[model samples]
Target: MADKEATVYVVDLGASMGDCHNGRDESDLDFGMRYVWDKISTTVAASRKTWTLGFVGLNTDETNNTQDEEGLEGYHNISTLQEIGPMTMTELRELHPKVKPCEAYSGDALSAIVVAITMIEEFTKKLKFKRRIILVTNGESPIDDEDDSITDVAEKLNEHNIELVIIGVDFDDPEYGFKEEDKSRAKRQNEETLRKLVEACENGVFGTMQQAVEELSIPRIKPVRPFKAYDGPLTLGDPNKYESAISINVERYFKTKRATPPSATTVVVNPDRGYTQSQAFDDGDVEMGGTEFSNVKHMRKYKVNDPSAPGGKLDVPYEELAKGYLYGRTVVPFSDSDMAITKYETTKSFTIIGFIPFDSYSPFLNMGETGLIAAKKFDEKSEIGLSALIHALHELESYAVARYVQKDGAQVQILLLKPNPGIEDEYECLYDVPLPFAEDVRSYQFPPLDKVLTVSGNVLKEHRLLPNQDLKEAMSDFVDAMDLSGFDVDEDGNPVDYAPIDEVYNPVIHRLNQAIRTRAVHPDGEIGPPPEILLRFSKPPEKLIKKARPDIEALIDAAELKKVPEKAKGRFKEAVKPLSGLDIDAILGQKKRTVISPENAIPEFKQALATAEDDETVEKAVKQMGEIIRKLITNSFADVFYPRAAENLRVLREELIGLDLPLLYNKFLRALKKSLLSGELNGDRREMWFKYIIGGQLGLVTKEESEMSDVTEEDAKAFVKK
Candidate 1:
């Protein structure tokens, strides 16, 4: 058995932002790359147990620094654009390691595959076992050329059985340049290419960085020890005194590997029924299972009767007796059995003798051989039958040992072979014992038999099988230690429940926030005003909302209604403010002759709609005109305050939907409640009332709020006052 278990090699190709965008880091772009890299690296490092890591950089393919002095050739960088290098575990540790700000070289796709595959092959050759390669990339093949394809490279990799994973990082492009038409198209194309690459390679892919990290993880492994072996009874006359040597010629009777059909010939034994089951007879009387399960001893019957010669003594040979029972048995000499064998004529046989096993001897044998000859009882111990009896005993012991070893799950062979040249020709055995205990003679003992045995090739008949359990455990331990869970990539990549959801959810919200903030800062740059407002104004909201109404009532109404007043108020005042103190009463109000002018019945309404030629009644003239006019004027004032009412509603709807809230009405109710609680408010503050209260957390505003508090209280107050 071996001391340590096998090894697995882990090559972590650390993350990189490809060299596509001129290596200039955009804030959103850099943030995304770092987020993905951190997730992937941390995940891979945590998962493996039996594996050791060998790190390599994929995009940064630097030149070879040393010459190959050991006649082992090295691979050249497949592309001139990437300056990549091979860093050992130590070399990587020495450097301040971080995912370098590298650009996606649209030509290094094949080079990346070549370097990765070659590195794994070379690294694992010394270890000499099954090797697995896990490559984590964003599925972006940097090679944009039409002439060369990475598909061919993937096929070559399939031959080596390296598992490739293309983790699609920044799957939802958070940057803002693409037009609305391109968003779905670009995303689809990127996803499709990613799918193709992963399919072309040997293994499947994990789409997001989160999944990639989870998939590349592993756990710890434990060690196991092997077992001990047992020995059986010895033949006293065996050549090695108390030893019994059985030579199993596995080639003649046993197969090297398990049989193709696995025990096609059946041999079964039921002790209660008193005989082995044979395949020739389908009945329970004959059983044939594995050689280990055979009860051949109980199945054999040697007839000693000489039918042709009536009342005459018959001669039987011990060699024929032994040969008839065991095909390839080897034996060695033992103590008193040698003398008994020389004195007794083993060739003698009797007339009219019947055959039965020694274990089932008739009552006559107990009364001595005289009872069987004088009382006309069964004949059993003919000279030839004794050899057959010995052969049966050998087979029984051999089968027991073979069955034991097989039950423990080890590989064992039952060899039936000729004995080695030695002192005398008799029966003995030299079966394989457990590794260390084979030499420990005292721990393993057997009962002595008076029969003689031989260690010579001629006297050696055949050796049978017995059980061995020690080897089985060793094989089982090997398989358990080599468990493939260590090979799973996702083991380490799983996210902890304790990890902050903001870190998980915010980059998405942050990108959306970025897109929203950009439009807020430069409305004309990308996100134009809402379709409703964009159609109304050629200029932006910043330029449009600057002017305000001079009417106190109108301004208060606008604030209460949460809306912007008409810009028409500013335009009209600009055009006509120079004349009549901007008095609209003289410009458009009706004339009256009553003590209280009719205009008093609806003061602001009169001015707002003075051009109305329709014969509408001024009923407040007959009632209390002053109070009625004021009410009418207040209602008109509200109309002037809320100008971009439609636009505000649209923008509010988008924000609420972006937040994934239940509905627009719910968001509006929330914003309304918030604004009512906080008296201090501005137009933008009102927008935020809708932005956060209605839109839920409004994503990643925590950083912005932190910066807000950093400004001095006085400055904040002053800024607020402004």
Candidate 2:
């Protein structure tokens, strides 16, 4: 029937097929074979109209010596399996089939099964809609009872990973005078052994020929093509009439698909922009950069603007956006200047800055868990590159330097603050000593107290006979009276006191020491306070040593001690030489606004005026004057009214000079300068131009001349000739 699936097999019983009768009567043998065959045929050919039949039988060893003289002299008859539609059957059959079984021989089940499996697997490998299998067998198996040789071959067939079916036709029956049960048992074992092979394949089976064929003929919702030719006699009962092909028009179906873009109506609210003008102005406009940009969105989305309102901006808590998209929290910020339009057009054509998913956390922040997991599972610690290590170190450094202060054993606060909304800021505590007791640099005066006492004694001895001195002397006396007590000698030579004594407490230093102590414990033996506490008290040099200890240890263990090399500072300096024609000071001072006339400016202007006599001369003088004025203006700008402002201007000048000003002027400011300098020269500036002409004649090369020298010889020749 069209619904039936096809199953076919080529059986190879090496040489023994002709002699044995499965140790039973021919009738019994026939009955057994027919019983299985009839059962399978009846089930498989239910509709009879569209049934397919494929068959092949070979006694390989028996036919090895026999040659086919004619078409059917020695070979067995076989039938070709045909495709059947859902509702049709075809006439086909296997007739006059011969079985020439041979005697005992060298058993090579491996080769036989390998060939059979290759054929079936190759055919069905690409047939996703259809499933198929092939059964190949020799009832007499050559498996050694002690060796599991058959199992070994069977397992290999299992790996071909395609549907398989096995048939074992043994002739070791008692009635056939073949008394050895080994063949029958071996056949049975071989047939059953195919389960592993069948299991490994998506659609595999193991049974007698009739039974297997019957199973193959059963209708399936999704029918699979047969693995081989069918074996049957030509009859009207053929079921090929019911078969029908099911084809799909892929081109037509896929043509209707549409390319999608993000919605134009999506208004992604920038959290930074959400702040009111008053808030932004007062808070200095929170400018975000890097991952902070993404973080702000996540925080804002989770916050309810009007949690109590019936229907406000955040009536629904923004946290709901985070519920399904926790894993998609890969957003990070970029500066507006850093953003490029091309970056937005990718495979997805994303809006790099827009649609900044309202709720998300930076995956970079989850590095602690990610790194630990990766390190454990993939040996990522060893595989991680220097860039990854650098990023991790930066994250660690930020976390390490952060300080949390707890006050009154209740309220907690983060001391570090962002420098600006855009820049990072950190907070640290400062020690402020009271003016009265500021001199007491230590607790309860032990080491520091001893030094103070020594100094005081020296002062007393130096002023021994000053008992009747002025208030300054009395104050000195009061200081000198401190000898582990608040006592001062009065002018009458008696002790006097101005203050009471009390026990001293030094909780600050004690707590600091306690914190250090707790950090010294090892993690393996006991979990201890962080190593940063000890690091804080250890001073710079020791702290550096402790910090590098782990990396040093790892390097030694990895046998990479040679990676660290001693520096040859002197050699490094020797390797570098000054470039010829380069004036170090001139290069360094390129950004400095040097005044053209260092002496009295009025005198310089008078000298310039004396040299200018004609229009061209005056024009030259004016040009020179203009240049001087520009330089002076620059100098004045660089040296603003305040000293600090001047310093800032100097820094600004250096940075400005770092830019390619010639390029900048050409691209952005040349036209503006031309516009400003246009018009007839008839004023005092014209006389200044004459002075510049005189200066040029006297061999003073101006900046314009320097620029002209940079032009190529060809360009220069072309310009001069023109």
RMSD of each: 41.6, 42.3
lDDT per residue for candidate 2 within 522-623, as digits (tens), equals 112333243343234334335344555555454444432234334323101112224454666467784322232533434443344333333454334334
How well does candidate 1 score on lDDT at residue 648?
A: 34
Q: What TM-score does model 2 achieve against the real structure?
A: 0.21
Best by TM-score: 1
User: What tens-digit string does per-residue lDDT give for candidate 1 at 407-460?
Assistant: 233433221112212225543322221121233324556633322245562332
What's the lDDT for all of these models? 0.35, 0.33
Stretches > 4 Å off in candidate 2: 1-4, 19-23, 27-32, 39-53, 61-110, 122-125, 129-138, 143-161, 167-722
Report lDDT (Cα) of residue 545, candidate 2.
47
lDDT, model 1, position 17: 44
